[model samples]
Target: MGTTAYERVLSVAVAALHERDPEQLWPLLAADLPALCGGDALIYKLDNWNESEGTLGLSPGVTAEFTALGDEDMGLLRAGYPLAAHYASGPDRAPVTARRVAGRSWSQSRTAQLLDDLLDVDHVLGIPLPRSTTPVTGCMVYRSGRDFTDDELRLAEQLQPLLTAVEQQRQLLRRLDTPSQEAADVALTPRETTVLLLLGDALTALSIGRRLGISERTVHKHIANIYRKLGTHDRVSTVLHAQRLGLVPTASAARP
Candidate 1:
């Protein structure tokens, strides 16, 4: 990608990282990704195999095409064409194109024809996010005339890590949103709970303030509220108390 395009994608990635709502992540990515990657449209998939189970987010441009599909067509799309089948049984999680996966048989394959007939796209590039093997999580880009280029594939690989970080942030936000016994007992506001989670990471007040885009004084105020709610004096004790309450994941329980 050129410098300008790289900047645009970077800007989107940064905005995604700072988004506090997990549900917004998919829409945000879906909107910008097609243009950035030189594709006509895109979809972000949470799980693709089960008709009733998975979530799908389409780019604004492709929403109508997706909505036009019948129940049976939707079911077939959820089968994830060829890429999901390949990724599920193997460890190669790199981004791949459907044409590349199916090679000379691409035009004759039912999956390819289905996508072409339903979504009006002749090719697809699957960019698998860093997630579980089953259910097939990630974005799929579509363009009509040709497959994605080597440079586009390289760009997808470059983007994998940033996408992973954003997803991780989304998961953390999700946990904070979930109603739990510990959360009910302490009654920490969502923002304060986020601050407390940062405290558990040993971030200074200034660092927490920077992380949340607030002033150090505001961070200190949140810290004070957390201490009072958790009935603790210092950061360590506050974190320890929160951990014991199951408000935050314990050190050992934290994901790598």
Candidate 2:
């Protein structure tokens, strides 16, 4: 069967996102949206567990309000809007409102208020990707003075699966940086393994000692043993080696 326009656009978006370098991804986002929706595109990393402390922009001339949205903004949205929850629950599409309270006024939704305060965005169509659990990593297509049309919304929806796959690949690449557990365990003793596991949970020597019913000095000794076994000089390296060997599951890998 022939591919639809939506399929073609979505394929291109996914390809752009999955590019090895950020240089390639940004251009596709910037150029495609202007042609598709007649408005600029803004991409955010949505890091720090609450959409804070990440880069934001199209190409650098767009002039976004929050280069990185913060915890407070996320909290407000969660408390006042249904968008976050709906996305987490696997909604294919979400609506952006301008007010905190829905059905009260167009001026009540937090999304709308942000648009009014931040940029020239009037209405937004939020097409959430599959991998995004809390509305953190998805595209927010904006119109200066117009609402999204049915065709545009349909196009965005079609892109969701590809967008999700791109995110998964990005996450997988990050995991590659962690140390392997097999490498860590090469010369580690049983006691060192236990210590490494505890350390991976962010436990200090004293805390590990308490948990293992040993003295703090003994915990330190175990950590030293762990480091020697793994051929690492520090706690971070020790834990990284443990992760690579499957000694500890990363948060990303632990997700269902």
Candidate 3:
């Protein structure tokens, strides 16, 4: 039997939460989310316009097409496409389609024309992440045919919290990926960070191993590496030190 939409979303949620590497999450989602949300293709952009720049990810083929735009097209994109402008001007982070945002004027709008010419798509559904700041962050769902239906829009909205969870995990992974002055001396490898985070949850070596799909012996090896790197001899102190170093979230905010 085919999976229900809810089941599919649940499957996505599980897979996303299991992902340990922040860099891999985008491609993982981009692989399946477009079809789930009723679009031909999807591209996720994170803090795209920031000075520090941002990351963009999608299926490899589409990634090339999306980023190969010429200077003029790049300039046009930076001007804030309709849905991006809508969120940038206010607090609403709801997913919106280009047709809905541009209405009757969409046919003539430069942004619409640009998308058609560039992506060969007639409509876009911007799923901006929840933000109270500039440089809207999230994915854009593109399709060549009709605009997303109300049901599809609602489905996209329902997935927002899951996306937020993934983003939160991504931020934690980012901290682990970047070494600040304090953390420079104590930086843990991505695998070690994952093990440390699991340690914070009080999972045993065997449990962590099972969760990570590794042998218990390998889990112990990672745990030992984490302890040596964090200058801790045991799980409790290791997790505590990791939290202090901002390598993992605080107790209340730790992964559930």
Candidate 3's residue-wise lDDT over 1-256, tens digit each? Answer: 1268888887877787667678887787788788888888876777754323455566545767766776666655555467767787788899989789889787688877987887788888888776526777888888997889998899899877767766765765764534457875675665667777788889999987766656899989989888788778988888888888877777887854
Q: Please report how far candidate 2 places residue 120 from its true position, in Å.
A: 1.4
TM-score of 2: 0.48
**RMSD of each candidate relative to the true structure:** 6.7, 13.6, 8.4
lDDT of 2 by residue, 168-210 (tens): 4344333333335455437554345556666776889998776
- List the candidates' TM-scores in order: 0.72, 0.48, 0.68
TM-score, candidate 3, is 0.68
Highest TM-score: give the candidate number. Answer: 1
lDDT of each: 0.77, 0.54, 0.75
The true-versus-predicted C-alpha distance at residue 130 of model 3, in Å, is 2.4
What's the ranking of the predictions by TM-score, best on top? 1, 3, 2
Pairs that collide, model 1: none
The reply for model 2, stretches above 4 Å from the true place, is 1-18, 22-31, 34-38, 43-60, 63-82, 88-104, 134-136, 176-256
lDDT of 1 by residue, 84-169 (tens): 88888877889999889888787787767887887788988888875557766888888888788999888887777666655655
Better of 1 and 3 by TM-score: 1
